[model samples]
Target: MDKRESKIPLIRFPEFKEGWEHKQLNELLKVSKKKNKDLKYSKEEVLSVSGELGIVNQIEHLGRSYAGASVHNYGLVENGDIVYTKSPLKENPYGIIKLNKGVPGIVSTLYAVYKVKDNNADGEFIEHYFSLDANTNRYLRPLVRKGAKNDMKINNEYVLHDRIFVPKKEEQKRIAHFFNVIDTKINQLKEKQNLLEEYKKGVMQKIFTQKIRFKKEDGSDFENWDNTTLGKVFKIFNGYAFSSKDSCENGVKWVKIADVGIQRMQRENVSFLPFEFRELHKKFLLKKGDFVIALTRPILNGELKIAEIDDFFHNSLLNQRVGKIISSNNLIFIYYFLQQQWLINSIEKNIAGTDPPNLSAKEIDHIKVSIPKVKEQEKIAKILSNIDNKIAKSINQIDNLKNYKKALLQQMFCY
Candidate 1:
């Protein structure tokens, strides 16, 4: 531990000027070894501790019961109780601690349950101390021990005796509350994003089914839609067969079928071709407003990921198993139409039942559709696009807030 950490954290409240005192975990918190008393009948929420989500009710989260035959022998935990799952995780080798709140519940027997012994020793403060980058990547990592089954576990004695520097009770509460406020804001934004997405989905269904028809400019009914083959409106094109040797770090972007999904194009997993060979990939390069889909996955419920490429994804070369649809019709309208269940089912029926189902470019070209007139298509696009914009903005805001909190966790704690 750095000498400076013993005296103060990288950031702190202005009023707390004294150095924090170090104490062993056992001295600060008491182990809760009491077993569940409801042996006759278990009725409370069945809890489990996940290193990622912390402690949560298993049945509610999984949409079904994952609770063993019964949790009669499980450990009991109450509000403000701190629980630790002592199993190793790939990212967090020393296990993880979660402070349970809101209700009293029962966790599996295979966890360490404890209570704050010192009235001044806040559970939230301890949770933050353990979670901070300065402690996770630096202090706790080194203390993990190799145990039976080759799993990493911190020695019970070592963990119990491990010392941590803590601020006064009031200061600790303030710091914990600061993070809580941020968490509440993030959750609110997430709920807003979810509602917007659901609203857009419902609207799409209504418009496609003609339940909500678009009117002509003069407030008159538009002409009936005409049935037409997709080939007339779209020029279907399959991606190039790029070899492994063509991969490069700093080169032209090569978008594979897997790189594109319903959530939009994934930027991090994209591969590239040598910049010098950009000329060779010119014919395969994608442009803004191109409709693309993963042909290899065929079409399965929720497996169909199709989207219209925006300027952000322009100039990208399409790789094998991906197909792009170029058309004069509004690309945005075609993008959403492809996502409708009927179109997805039509595309799936063409697959030949190969190990991994695949779609042929010809099949995509020949599929028939009843399209709206150009004006109606544009109107539908605007409604859907507006909701998309709202969802996108909320998602971006949530991501930014998470990053901001992560930065604070790293900088505010002692090293």
Candidate 2:
């Protein structure tokens, strides 16, 4: 192994005998707050932002729901610029900025951009260091204020005044290179995962719509698919309204729609309800294999369609606006089927809502579904389940790697 030393030996290379130089951010950088810039852009050139991945240029506002506004004010950003939102106080408030292809607009007023000092460091290298998980959380977390109306509000002064370790230029580049290699692998896997999901969604659409049919081993089509209402095939029930007044540390497990994470049901995030209330709402208790669907959401255009009730979440009861699928026609099959895009489109077409879109039991009952033989359904589920199993395993590995990298950074870098 190549030996390295510094205040922390692991942070610097062995060949590098120079001690780290501490410096104020402004002294080593040209800091430009987007809000303070005097730049302007036409509506056509206006850029949209989300967190730190600067200036989306597709002009395709294809989101799960509504798209956000465009930034048209004074904000200078180019390739390699580090951009971060400065208004909303958030748990982790910063990200390394990037200007995507086809993007031609200036930075949004929400960002604070930093151009590295030519005498001191490489801009890309600094951006990479700042993008490190530990640095982002360590530097930005404390800048957040609790009572701020916006979730994040970081000013230029706070960031500029914070003291940071400035390694020699060569070391900075080397460290950035190491992390960038790992990051590329992680990003590549993530893209594969996304593509696999899209493929599965497409397959689901074909199967449910009868565009593609599952054939029996005998080379014959499983009898003409029957049409059935979801209500008949599954038991749909509303969740219990656990009283906020009696909420305490030790109580029965309760879940809200918000408790459901993007891809999995967050059993660990569950809150406890009073025992009396739990007993009263016992009928609505969750069981493994049960599906929980978010019934109330303004963006009900089919996002967050389903969640399986895992064993860890057993005895948990759903809360108001969340729909529990107590029983179903082979849940494993239903789970994969609901994840299909075509099914989501169908649900969206039939969904009824006011200000906050809500899917009712009646509307759910009217949802048309292809009824395949239970055995065939199980078979199809198995095929898709294997693919998903691989995807989940890959994600777990990535999480472990990220955690390991975080731990390594903490040990190697000075906090």
Candidate 3:
């Protein structure tokens, strides 16, 4: 093969022996001029181009339509049409290209839609090819001129003038199908995770509300749950105020507010303190099985920013604005009970008008809770923990699959 035509991906199917062809995108695509000029598609049919979800219904994705008063001037996007969103994103500053694989819809004028020009190329292949951030950035960086407002300044037709390498039609189809299978697997895992979460939520509601109750080993009924304020059960205290300047490279892990996720600890961007600080901040130290909650902005997306310290975060120093809960009662039972929606509602009611939504030790202590006998608490906690373990496993599997797909994208496409 000629040197100019020798461009090929690092990984290719055994059946494909030839190098990929180098050509301008315009050779395979053309700007879509179709519009909703006749008012055939309403604002209800408006679509939004998402980097992760591709082209999706604007209302369904965002929970509301952001379309302007007029819809007749919107671009009409048909199935398999390529849409470019000119809006800048953190990952794709030059914008992103996505294929509309769903029903025909109308997109706002900010989006540029295009159609496949001929049988020489596949739309799905183009979509997958640009799916990699490096691929999209490299192709668009030089061509996308930024306006004063940081918006994309390139014309829709000009975007297709960039050169790209493409395999034969058959190879293109195979590659697209391969990635599609991976995507399907990811989606299936996500669905399973969602169902498990829903099941857990429902079961937790029933258990906490006393709609369902556990019994003794003999299957006889246990005593009714007793109501008590959180203060009567657990001693909640905020962590020590650690100075950022004192942070060290290696030593005790620092559990900052950002590290506390909903029912999980986020280890990304972790910071550490000097080993000597552990003795100085013994009161703020967190051990394994410790329960902690964010005092500032305690709730996110309707979920509490609370989690139990696991092995990975054991012996860590908790930073200020994070409350540590210590209890003589079954801590696991209390942790699960706090996750109940009704309990969260009670917390929200206390902090209703507070700006930035924070919680004080006094206010948290005043919150009421219901508890059963120690044996019943142990049984209930065991059941809920089992469900949580399954959810965590599903999440880990999804993350692994996503990482695998990311690796495949890097090797399967020529940069």
> How does each model score on TM-score?
0.86, 0.79, 0.95
Point out the higher-scoring one by TM-score: 1 or 2: 1
TM-score, prediction 1: 0.86
lDDT string, candidate 3, 302-349, tens digits:
889999999999999989989898787888988887887877888888
lDDT of each: 0.75, 0.63, 0.88
Highest lDDT: give the candidate number. Answer: 3
| Per-residue C-alpha lDDT of model 2 across residues 1-415, encoded as one tens digit per residue | 1123335435555776777666556666667654423435544444455443434642444333221364434566655555565544243444333323344455455566666677777665565555565576666655555344544555655666555676777877777677668777877878777887777767666777778777788887787866776666676688876677767788777778776654477655567877777678778788776778877761344465477777777777778878776544677787776665555666666674465667777766777676787878887888778778877877887787677766656654554
RMSD in angstroms, candidate 3?
2.2
Candidate 3 lDDT? 0.88
**How would you encode candidate 1's per-residue C-alpha lDDT over 1-415 as one tens digit per residue?**
2233455778777888877777666766888876777563264476766654667777666666556776778888888888877666766666677888656788776577888865768888878777653465455566666677756565444556566677788888899999889888998999999999889879989998888998878999877776897777666678889987978788888878767777487676777788765687688888887778877884545447787677767888888888887777887887777778777777777665676887776766678878888788898888888889999999999999989988887766654
**Per-prediction tally of clashes:** 0, 10, 0
Candidate 1: deviation at residue 350, Å? Answer: 5.8
Which pairs clash in the backbone of model 3?
A: none
The model with the greatest TM-score is 3
